[model samples]
Target: MSHSVASPSPKLSSWTHTIGASLEPWINLTRVSRFAGTMLVFWPYAWSLTMTARSANLPVARFFYLLFCGFIGASLSHSAGCVWNDILDRDFDRQVERTKGRPIAAGKISVPSAVAFLWAHLGIMLWMVRDVNSLAFKIALVTMFPLAGLYPLMKRITYWPQAWLGISMNAGVLMAWAFITGSIPASAFVLMGGTWAWTIWYDTIYACQDKKDDVKAGVKSTALLFGNSIKLVLALFASLMMSALVVVGRLNGHDLPYFLLSVVGGSIYLAVQLYAVDTDSPKSCWAAFHRNGFNLGALIWAGFLADYIWAAQGPALVDFARGVAVGW
Candidate 1:
């Protein structure tokens, strides 16, 4: 009886390997190590929520809840967009030294498997935003098609794929505004414009990493389009972004501190990045791109958070001061 033990079935082993292989590529394709990109995508949404909550006196708990939702939505949507991009650009990725190791390009995943993964991500994203306000939900629906569906094709048709990306990526500013205010505003568009300019600036830097391969592969991008004038283009976009920031701050009645930290500080950081970036060096381009996540993104959010805290607490502090004065 003890000698009657049986070996594992070959069919079971084959099925196990198939399941693991199917899921493994998803982790690589999502580029989870590049967490910076996800946070950068999430920041505009968080900023809108914080600013709107401050101005509207919305409950702090509600603001946090919505911000968390934006984080999850942004991450899922960004991952889906990446998978779609990889699927569309598999051939192009194989030609680029930097992207040649990508899951789809390396043939670690089949296109059908990738498509399935993409739909799964989109399905979860939809579920996450389902409880949001109607305006936000509608905007999310409309924008998802363009960002996740059309963005991968833009690179084939236009040198301004970065511009398309700008429009798509920053649409979150509007969605977040609608989520909180139940309607979008003129100011939200202004902020969106600023966010668009910022996208062009940083994405151009990101594109620089693949400029040589992109050109060889006939892939058009702002990095290739701008060429020797790339720095000038970055400067112009950075200025536009800063101007938009100033306008949005004024529209929202943000205090001097907000302008100083978000607008001024962010400008200085961008300037340093521009100065330090070597457009010809892929390493420099990658560094500059990642820097945008923390330097500009965190600075802007810090200003908004500080402003919100002060606005919520300032009256109490003033009242205490007045009471002390009267007692004295």
Candidate 2:
């Protein structure tokens, strides 16, 4: 008797189930806050602010080319990094209450599958920026290395991992500026540095929510490490963030009004953060962390608005799109 070879069925049901299981926890939606935090870290707002500094006489074609490309690339990098971070931290995540239900941590995605997905996301980021300057490309590559590798381990050993996280997040700002201008100026460095510090301060507040679980799991974090002093720590960092912003304004030769208005807005926001912050309360920590998004948007707007005010009607708002297109 000859045995007939059997062909495999499509297994559509199994495939659909598998995909649904894998995607459901990722769609938790509360995670969107984390993603937003990641996006802000890329400082796309800062890039837009810098574009406002470009001369109006510059060709619109090049400005928009740079603007669109820079914005999209930074966004992709931000998303890819966030996804990859979730993947890498999956194992450790299960040990923490807040993260235990995440898709990867819950075994909805197997470790190998999560790893492949991370690489794929990062690959997309690479392809997105392929046409950028060689120097910028190299910087981007180096920047992502830490995100995929060392960043996950940071919580294992340091209370200040948020500092490194900020560096990774701000790397896009530096790379984009260099890609457009072909050189790293003191102004870009200073502004990006300020943005980085701002990220650290805010992310620390975020980490505060997980402090108890993190300590139980033997993970180091600013929240867990600071313990009873987290409020004071937050105040210190917030003050430093404002000081850095003031330095940025001075470095850019912004007028006193620019500094006063921006700093006043920032101070008011910071005061709000300080007044209601409660390190031991996870709900309060989440609220405080989300407030940073507003701060990020406000700070960027402050800088851009100041530039507009000082530049005498600011390069014809109608030409904004055209100017961005041509590298103004």
Best by TM-score: 1
* TM-score of every candidate relative to the true structure: 0.90, 0.79
RMSD of each: 5.1, 9.0
Model 1 vs. true fold: TM? 0.90
C-alpha RMSD of candidate 2 = 9.0
- lDDT of each structure? 0.87, 0.67
Error of 2 at 118 (Å): 1.3
At residue 303, give the lDDT of candidate 2. Answer: 56
Residue ranges of candidate 1 with Cα displaced over 4 Å = 1-24, 320-328
Model 1, 34-139: lDDT tens digits are 8878877888887888888888898888888888888888888789889989999999999999999999899888899889988999899888778888898888
Candidate 1 accuracy as lDDT: 0.87
Clashes per prediction? 0, 14
Candidate 2, superposed: residue stretches over 4 Å from native:
1-22, 26-35, 44-71, 255-257, 305-328
Q: Which ten contiguous residues of candidate 2 have the minimum total lDDT?
A: 49-58
lDDT of 2 at 69: 61
